[model samples]
Target chain A: MVLLACGTAMAQLPIYNVGRAPTEAELHPSDGVVGSDGKELPPGRGTAKEGETIYAAKCAACHGKNGEGIYPWPRLVGGIGTLNTPIPVQTVGSYSPYATTIWDYIQRAMPPFPLEKNLTPDNIYALTALLLYWNGIIKEIDVMDKNSLPEVQMPNRHGFYPDPPQSTPNKDGTWQPYWNQAKPAAK
Target chain B: MNSKMSDRRGFLKGTAAMAGLAVGAIPFANGNALASVTPGEPNTSMGVTKLGVTPDEPNIQDLLYGGRSRYETTVRIPSVGWNGATGLRNLTPLQDSIGVITPSSYHYLVQHDMHITNIDPRQHTLMIYGMVDRPLVFTMEELKRLPSVSRIHFLECTGNSGLMHYKSMLHDQKLGRADLTVIQAMHGRVSTSEWTGVPLSLLLKGAGVQKQASWLVAEGADLCRHAKSFPLAKAMDDVIVAYGQNGEALRREQGYPLRLVVPGWQGVNNVKYVKRIKLVDKPYYLGRETSSYTNLKPNGKASWYESQVGPKSLITYPSDAHHLPERGLYEISGLAWSGRGAISRVEVSTDGGRTWKDAQLQQPVFRKAFTRFRLGWNWSGAETVIMSRCTNEYGDIQPTMLELAKLWGDQVTPHYTGEEIEHWWETAAIMEFLNNPILPWRVKPDGSVQDALYNTLYNTNGPSKNSYYSGGKI
Candidate 1:
């Protein structure tokens, strides 16, 4: 087949600029992505107690009775201090570095099957709280919201160390590492 | 190979061989009726006639009358997969594959979920919004109108060769012969195709991307709405909002209508059935982005290792589980590819990794696409090991199994859970997620190439005492 590098040599312009301007209303619902700072989280509130009931009905079938994880389906609890072990069981309590990721995932793609079954903001919040509480990251009565969700510290929050930025080739074409790479100071 | 019989020139050659076989050689599984048609015989009832017959009997036409045909012999070898899902992917037949271009039909598929999306081109609309001056929505027809490009590139899954980490356990009785060809089963996940699509840069330019945008969160149209964030730098570089594969509309499994082709990156980042492109100042930290694809480091930390399909080459003809007919005068053929750039060279070694010789690369080696390489060798019937190594344009060389094991640090054990299970790998099973190690095929004295556990084993001890990372008497 004729292989033309798509955007290279941008000479002759505007062949098929046929898209319409999207309205704000059309963009909002699909646009919500709760950030690490909780900037875009939608109005929602749920307690771990409220989430336990929803977990049994909507999630337990695939995630296990108590978040132990069904086979093929991922395990969601336990393994809190196992990351450094030879056989690290990377469950939610032990591995997920961010709490916002948990909430965003349940809302966007959870229950696995039937694809995007829209979970209400409250349902998502409750499920997120239930998961955290079951993993011992949060208390049973702790209520989760847009403000509190991002504030919850995950066990592995400080476990990660950012990679040193990769260095480009030098002017003389010799390979070189990034100079004076910044390392976090020891406590 | 049903397609083989249909070709007039090839069929003539086949007829000579056919006379020696049993009557009515069935072509496909379940003994289909197509096999009943005898060679050199004209069957007007099925609208098929001999190659040189008159037009009166609806004979097969010449090359100008082009159309597609079904083939049974060219089939993927299947294996048990996640959840026994309906969306199970079959491995590509790399042994039979020739040249750089993988037929769209043979392109390996890896579905995250069970949904094989059937999106209507007319109904599908790609939305580009967030951190943009103009939020835009385009139909499939509209996107086709933009300045387009067709490129030859390879797409590979992050877990493409993950099974190689347990090569020793794979041959054990518990795992059995079923997992023997872990290379074929997993390596097939990487395939090259000529993809056609509009440049993602043009779409971003059309949206008037905001200066603050540092990431582009691409979303797919499937049920999971599978989403991932790509560095804005790469998005504006060589990315393509692709809709066609191998010169035609994409096959259903390859994301028909539209998808993102992030040249040279991990396949998961190339988001299939792509529907939205949202620009943001920071990464969205999507569930998949945060958890699944990260490389678990030996220090117990994780690194977001995406982009750049590692340098790898496999000797397909002399690969795992395949027996050689005879020892003398064999042309060793294989495929080598790199996400960094074009494959600069490929080296073959007949005596394990002790020595190496350069292989001839077939022409038309495009950047980020599979480069076919071949070398001729005459074996005198002595048992030996054969391996291949590749170096990309970026000067990155394929690492050995020993080196990769050290790099990833021996945490390679399999995490099997059932209480009734047996023979799980030892805890110190040092894993290499991107296993591009030099695979050594042991050719036995009988002219049959035997699949050996050399990668997992160090000394002459066999499979049971393999796992060199587990202190197995190396």
Candidate 2:
């Protein structure tokens, strides 16, 4: 039996994670942020030109000059429609949604290194404008600030909509939730 | 490659000195002779307890291991002083065609910040309070004294490799994408041990848990003080106050002394260095919860207090920077689990986004425990992408990183919990341009990972450049 199964892939199983059992949980897991206005929006802002400076100073090393990410690092630009395809997937102009998100990403976890020092509201805003200008979301001469920032609109903004509330009141107040959606239908 | 019993024994001596060649440290799990794995019927020839300990508890390297393919680099848990040696990393114990229990020292771990050396256990103490009859404090020994109840479980991090993205969002990513470090990854990180500890229900009973109590705040002793709140219902159901891991005193990195073990949930829920367990009525967005690990998206939103870990699957052997030999009967191995329930099915894809074949799942596919999956394939040796998709009992399919990122925003994953597989063979390489940036941090053979050394040379866009609003006026 052992030799017969020697070539079976499942037979070589070594590690495994159990089903979602109720175990002791952390008192403090990372308290990741989201803005009240659906913002990972950092407390920062910037313009396309200044963003260029910030991006060059902080992101250029890894993302390179054109935002065409490097080995294992991934290019930050293009590849918008590459999803579900053989073409390499990239981010920013081709993917991503809001300008606040770009700023938020930089504020939260970009640069890939030097750790969590936090970007300035100005530089963050600037970088968002720079990436936008590069992605053609905004023009090179556009001045990016809070009011224009929210209105700058992204290419893939149409890809998303507000998630239906996980727990919601049904049309008839039947409240057939997602968990119960497909169930009982089989009957 | 080794005997099951020896594997268990090795867990006991995880810190032992082996033959002076490679890591030389032979795990000494055999030393704990009379330690019986928490009573559930001994399920296999080798028994390793599952999810009843701290997240940092270093045990028999379980999870998925890579690197150290050379004798000089035999993986050994690296400490700061260890002469820059590689350490042990284990694989996820999936394939059920094998047995019930996971042998000690062969689970899986994906450590963060790569904690080395030890966090003095003697100084560790677990304290509990909030809406209780009496706030309680227990040393490691005090936790052991409570009636022990051991059961099989799995602890999966929601962010586990959400970084590696691909087409179908399953077996596309490479080997577990965190640490080559042992103390945290594999052997030293997540492990299945026959943990013998107090059922949290009993502890709540002793404290006279209040009727209105909703959540329990579990805090750790790590420098970060990793803390989080768990629902009370879960606490009583499968949670454990684990004092022993894999039939031995828990390792320092594994939250020695005492730690909270919440099975079938995200690993982040399992608090290590448990200094306090205060029952609260609401969830607090602590640092780890609000900032570091949660999934953020390109949109302005972060997913905080996400307690449920989604279904996920990853190929272990030929993952990440691997060379595919002319594939004929190549055994494909990986781990699969769910937060809502059991992993009912796992599908494999070989031709990048083309076709998929059902892979065999090992026996005794329990709920909330790592289910080993394997498949035999004849690789045409072409540059093809391979991926795995996991379907849990609830039928909540593991979404691709792209899909998930679209839905879940702000603190979304580049890797962590995002499910997608990008498998490419035939030696295709990352596109190179003049002075291409985006260099990743180099991981040292001695369990040390340098973040974006190359990334730094290219992109400087990180969090440090942002504004800081003093977490609340100090």
lDDT of 1 by residue, A125-186 (tens): 99999889988999999999988999999998766544321122335322211111212111
lDDT by residue (B156-216, candidate 1, tens digit) is 8766766423343343425443433544554667889999999999988877889888888
Candidate lDDT values, in order: 0.67, 0.47
Give the top-scoring candidate (TM-score): 1
Candidate 1 — which residues are off by over 4 angstroms? Answer: A1-17, A30-32, A115-118, A161-187, B1-72, B77-87, B164-180, B411-431, B453-474
Question: DockQ (Cα-based) per candidate?
Answer: 0.23, 0.02
Residue-level error in angstroms, candidate 1, position B379: 2.2
Candidate 1 docking classification: acceptable
DockQ of structure 2: 0.02
Q: Native-contact fraction for each model?
A: 0.34, 0.00
Q: Distance from true position, residue B197, model 2, in Å?
A: 2.0
Q: Model 2, B65: alpha-carbon shift in Å? A: 21
